[model samples]
Target: MMFWLAFMLLLSAAQRGDAQWDWLTGIFGGGTTGSSTGQNDPNCGVAAGSRIIGGQYASQGMFPWQVSLQNLAQGGSHGCGGSLFNNEWVITAGHCVDGMTNPAMWRVRMGLASLQYYENGEQEFTVTKVIMHPSYTASAMGFPRNDVALMKLNRPATVSNYVNNICLPDRDASVGTNCVVSGWGVYDIQSQYFGQAPLSATLKWTYAPILDPGYCSQNYIWGSEMVSSIMVCAGYDHGQDDACNGDSGGPFICPSPDGSRWELNGIVSWGEQPCGAQYKPSAYTRVTAFKSWIQQTIQSN
Candidate 1:
């Protein structure tokens, strides 16, 4: 049933689902005063941002093989984005787990560049599955096709100096370089909670450019069910910044083609609503055009 109507439209677009408008966009139609203004505000709808200057134990400049995939990543918590093909693997956003497909409900918590969530923090693990990436379709959530996902972790994390991993998108990782899109998300788009607020951004590569298939299906507002070889787009057509919703999966890196270091060419999928809305750009999910379905789904697990 199309992944169970995308898992009941992803639990009626769970913004921590408790009630409010969102019976699949019926526009604030539930109760509890729009569900406590979407639970004390700041989820301004549609994928969103904030995470600049390398993190997660960021390095790679003076030695230690130039690290940083956010040292493994840390934000509001319970997974959204972090680790880029290393630390035994983590990467995220299969719709954050889309209807919780159970991988031990994912734990992963790495070094902490922000978002504490209680003392003695940082370094938590427990997943073991949740691959997603069979080529997500149904015209994806606005260029969300194959939104990307991983996880795996059931024992393999102990690289010090603050965790590691960050490199994956070198099948000629191209598209006008100069990237760097970390996460922990949130840059005050009206402060509804402002993402993780650990913040990170570099947004350039032509200030978010990639789409062109008839201009992403004649531009926005549901652009004719966008689909051009499986969707891809970038941001800043003169406004709106992104990586919203706790920064989905994370990583929009660059600098590879043998120039060495910094790869991960895309993962923070879906956009075109708020978190950088202005001619609506911001869309991803083209990790080297689906690197062979992410190495045959992580080598058939």
Candidate 2:
């Protein structure tokens, strides 16, 4: 509607929702989900190609950019994974629709693979509107900063087969660059503890250089400067990697046109703590620094 209130803000990037598009919004982390020590807790997710390890890289198409969304108007209740930029926009991360001003709560669930259980094609829409970033603010919780958001689908979104859309990153793309962030997130593997379902996670990969934001904020070189013009960072730090709970608003894609080509750079915002367990790096929200507020909020709705 209002372009899904500037991209369904949900920076915990962990928030998620979907009750069969009952409209409105709003995980599993520790214990029970598999057991064995929570199934070897690498964050949990063993086999279906592990879940949330963050460094996210192993790759080969990883479910062609998973997307389930399904009726949400309550802050990512359990909905996250967007990147389709056509037929009504869907490039998430404005904290997954910042606290709904209320457009009847919100609803959108397109083509699923696994948000719980859906196999034979998925599609559920009704988010009359949602378009955030009048200066997005996590407003609370560890204060991740400006984070990002986008959603607008009272209609439009009926791709086919494996659901589509995933490419953006070339507003001259390059700021200490390195991109590629796949979703349907969470990963650990081998030892065990894998949760979430939806295959093709052939162990998605890519965590290179990942820096931007005046040097990736030197990573809190004090904690502030790295606001990095709105966020866009990644990591390596000598250990496993991360990005779990449901890979929220997916797409940190980057490679640059002249750099080799691979647009859509930034959307999977929220990180610096979980996922990719090391040197703390996983921030995204610099889609070319908002590209004129996403073409002035998707060409004025």
Candidate 3:
């Protein structure tokens, strides 16, 4: 009888474990196969199409790695955009968390396509730690240098059809390579009132092409030497589609050589005052330059 009781207890515990697993999987849309957790995962960067700044609305699961960094103190307002580095970490602009370094005050929302609506696959997590690069510099006259940052989630995100990680670039994308930048940023800069630009309710993306650093440096109001080696410039000569306010910290992703996966090449750093201004392309923090730093930081912390 005692032997039979032990068997029943084991069965009950197993059933409870299965039930808990099912509940979590149901929330994140995870399947029996489990969540994709690394860059090597075949499902990383898998999206419905190739695409984001004069950007169009993205469909569901179009950019699975996109993340909305929300400020809890401000009523969960979406402050900056980010990309999923992995199940436990998120990559974003350093300036986004500069003054707001308290991890408890921040939340990350993923698997989301709309800011106003919460979808079935959407996952939210409280940040446990915020790591900004030691060399990160915020400048009033020029774009921030070493603008990259990482936020550790309170819990690992479950990978699903709607959530995945983006692959980091091995090398810099060549000038003139077309890339996409996506966010829920402001749609109309001119329509803003009282110095406040309204953010988009839906995720939007636009195509931006990598531009020559020399040309970008020459065009900026700061003149030559404004565009640093660690930064990349991307936009058009006429400035039709460009990243604007509220789009900071988002990924500038380009297709790999074979076109099999998307690789993050840049992080939206800074831009001209009036967005989409002619001859004034936006500046992005070159991801390739800080690959080692990123790896070390993630590994040690």
Can you tell me which runs of candidate 2 are displaced by over 4 Å?
1-87, 92-121, 124-182, 189-230, 233-241, 244-266, 269-277, 295-297
Identify the candidate with maximal TM-score: 3
Q: RMSD in Å for candidate 3, one decimal?
A: 15.4
Each model's number of backbone clashes?
27, 89, 5
lDDT of 1 by residue, 1-301 (tens): 0111111000011012212111112112211112111111111111111222322222211111111222223322334564435344565546656556566555666545434332132356676777776655434323345666676777655443334445555463434444445554544444433433333332111124344545656635236555445445555455444455556666665555544344566766655333554555555666667766665665556
Where is the poorest 10-residue window by lDDT in model 1? Answer: 5-14
Error of 2 at 5 (Å): 27
lDDT digits (tens) for residues 109-210 of candidate 3: 998889898898899999989989998887666467789999988877777768877778878888888777888776674654356557778887777789
lDDT of each: 0.44, 0.47, 0.72
Best of the two (2, 3) by lDDT: 3
Candidate 2 per-residue C-alpha lDDT over 1-301 given as tens digits, one digit per residue, 9 for 90 to 100: 0011111111112222212112101121212121111011121111112233333233222333344453343454445567655545666776655665354675555445444554454566666667777777753344445666667666655433333344454364565554456655544322223433332323244444465455445543325543656566665553244454456576666554544224566766565333444455566677767766766766666
lDDT value, residue 138 of candidate 2: 58
Best by lDDT: 3
Better of 1 and 2 by TM-score: 1
